[model samples]
Target: MERDRISLTVPTHTDSPAQQVVQYAQNKDPPSRPLQNRLRKTLFIAMPPKKRQSDVVRRKSRQSDVQPGDPIPNRGKRRYRPGTVALREIRRYQNGTDLLLRRLPFSRLVREIAESVRPRGEAMRWQSQAIQALQEAAEAFLVHLFEDTNLCAIHAKRVTIMQKDIQLARRIRGVWGGLG
Candidate 1:
């Protein structure tokens, strides 16, 4: 019995490269679905199933069950009227009635300075009212100095208050000569 042998060689083409490319492209199988649809199908298969609304567990708190018209149950802590203290303090500060610096530190600093400047062998004592008055005065002076410095900075077309701005402010106020 004689067996027939088939040739497994690529056929030689006399066609141009562009024509061959077109022929090769035409011979290739087209996608059944769009690229986006294929990707969506693959992602859907890879993703876990989503929980339904009934399947999801929700926390039920006392606050959540309360209606808008109902009064809030007190937890034994004192609660102030909203914005009362904050707004009052802001207004006091704006009107130059409130002290900006902390009381304890300012009083300590004033005491130390007073002690250092006092005559040797002399004892110095300050009343609470005197210390409070001193702190208020110092804070007011500082606020005024800061305002002047800020003006100097603004004049120099800068937002930041630099040492130069402070120096300029002090010079303008005639206080630069004695301090330096």
Candidate 2:
């Protein structure tokens, strides 16, 4: 029976005598069948050699046109500075009233809540003026609650408002129940 063999060849560029000796020994004794199989598997899966960082060439971007000390031109959307209103926000403020709550939906919700609480035989109806007043009060209450919740989160050195922060805010405001 003819046995299958695999040979390992070392690079000729190796100048060291020790490397040459090792190469000769490797060539003299071919790898066993299992070792040859492992080598074949590894060869198939082996990744290509990575290029050194020093050898890599970076292409110049448009910013290269500017001198070393000069500022690079802003190419895209400009960011709003602190306390500066965006153009869209300014347009929105001009186009609509500054009220956060929409009257129609809020009034509907208020009427629904009142109807749910009233006795079955009794009817509940809200005046336009009363609904407007309720909407304003609800908006103010919500804004204050959110501000307090945000402050609580800030106090805890966190940027995100959590359920605990809201509960703490409600506790401070003397409100009884939260989402819990």
Candidate 3:
């Protein structure tokens, strides 16, 4: 098997700024170079052979440049947008399981929904447990939506989730009685 090697000549002078930079860059090793007052010493290092093409990364091919007159091919499905990284991150953060225990921003909306469900004549002030329960339920709902949508996207061999993925997730999760 072939091996790679690198050799560097280093000076032992303590006053040279370039030698100081090299010393700082490789601080883990002791200065084993010959300490001759006037002569420089050579340092030999052995490195492993270069990796094969299979060991190196294989990146996706970029789209070819198209002229204005070129007609785009008709792929049945529309491609996902690449610029929604922040939106996906926010969705994941909002759907985090920890949010179920903490206060949710939509707690007020939950309270209003609760108020609407109550009988018209009676005044009902929501208790802390009721609000907490509503918040937890909302969090669970969001988590389910995000998780199901992610699964739907993965099922279609896509990294980015599209609107169709969400719609399919809603159907699979029986959000609207599985009409689809």
Candidate 4:
């Protein structure tokens, strides 16, 4: 009959602060299980009906069993020859071709020329054009990168805001209250 623990006939959203009294009364275990069991006994609940029902509905979601002695389908096709033995001729030809390419001096010259043109003062007209093209390509790449990053960050911020709003709504029972 105490005011804090009292219940009224009509619903008004206010919970009593008398829960601490129940908490202190329990020594090691809470009596919530007994209270819940009593509640379930008194309540006549109906489940929401499913739109469709089938014989295999409850059973089809599980993995099909494969017995130990059963011959696995496509087992022979799964076998792959070891690459070291199977690709021996191809590997020998690749090594020979790689050695031939290494013997050529023009590729190394192209690499050196590529490195030298990087300086603003040393860059020739063609070199500068190539560098400008590279710069343009890099700028385009960066613009897209930043745009995606900012978009993702903005989406994350919006999600955080929505979550805060939901939490705030829960705390105040649909009334506006600051996030807990």
Candidate 2 collision pairs? none
Supply every candidate's count of residue pairs whose N, Cα or C atoms clash at under 3 angstroms.
0, 0, 0, 0
Which stretches in model 2 have alpha-carbon errors above 4 Å? 1-97, 176-180
Ranking by TM-score: 1, 2, 3, 4
Per-residue lDDT tens digits for candidate 1, residues 1-180, read: 233332221223334545534554467543354444322111111345566665444433544777799886778977789889888976887987667788988888887888899988898888999998877766767778888888999999997899999888888789433322
lDDT per residue as tens, model 2, 62-135 = 44556688876779988788546755676775587567777788888898889889978788877888988887
How displaced is residue 17 in candidate 1, in Å? 34
Judge candidate 2 at residue 52 and give its lDDT: 61
Candidates in order, TM-scores: namely: 0.46, 0.45, 0.40, 0.20
Q: Give all candidates' CA lDDT scores.
A: 0.66, 0.66, 0.65, 0.44
- Per-residue error for 71 in candidate 1, Å, reads 28
Off by over 4 Å in 3: 1-97, 100-104, 119-121, 175-180
- For candidate 3, write residues 45-116 as lDDT tens digits: 456576676544332122235556788788787655875877888888767646544465566677677679
Predict model 4's lDDT versus the native.
Answer: 0.44
Candidate 2 lowest-lDDT run of ten:
36-45
Cα lDDT for residue 148, candidate 4: 47
